[model samples]
Target: NYCTPYLGYPYYSSHDEMIHNLYHNDDCMPMRGFYRWHIQDPICFDEDLKVTIQQIGVGYRGLFERQDDVASVAYWYQAEPHNRFPKLPDKEERWPR
Candidate 1:
């Protein structure tokens, strides 16, 4: 079961479930995709913020950690007078393996 239960949002459930409710049924495609959370409910972070991802699975021996490759992109709106942005890596370095 690939569930995305994070923060206080239990309704997120699985990737397919969220995609089905947020977008048209036909809009969902397998594999490569992304999900936006601010659509249904918005979260306000006034202070520092941190994000983490975990992969767990169950088997005959019981629950255990699993290894997986994941990629993510985040978008946020900040107040005026923002700090200088950090330099980015070269195009070759930034490319996915």
Candidate 2:
């Protein structure tokens, strides 16, 4: 399970479950995604966790799933073992008013 399962918010604990729920079900998705660097960046609960990360997507039941402003992150598969990266801190560390 990846999601921490805190607060009243509901989340899939496993990667497969999360992906299945997000893509297979309309009731569960167009789910919101955010970064929590100060606390945690949504790490996987599994002991053999390697690439710890959370993924978010956009789209709703209609043509446009999300009706309001939302945040997102993108990852491009650049040539393996390359240096130089962009600076993107956790949602809180970057900006907050």
**TM-score of predicted structure 2:** 0.21
The lDDT values for all models are 0.62, 0.45
Tens-digit per-residue lDDT, 13-90, candidate 1: 224545546566445433343345564576668766677888797989999997755677766787899889889999
Alpha carbon deviation, residue 49, candidate 1 (Å) = 1.3
Task: State, as a TM-score between 0 and 1, how close model 1 is to the true structure.
Answer: 0.45
Provide C-alpha RMSD values for all models, in order. Answer: 9.9, 15.5
Error of 1 at 54 (Å): 1.7
TM-score, each model? Answer: 0.45, 0.21
> Once superposed on the true structure, which residue ranges of model 1 sit more than 4 Å away at CA?
1-36, 80-97
Model 1, position 65: C-alpha lDDT score? 94
What does the lDDT come to for candidate 1?
0.62
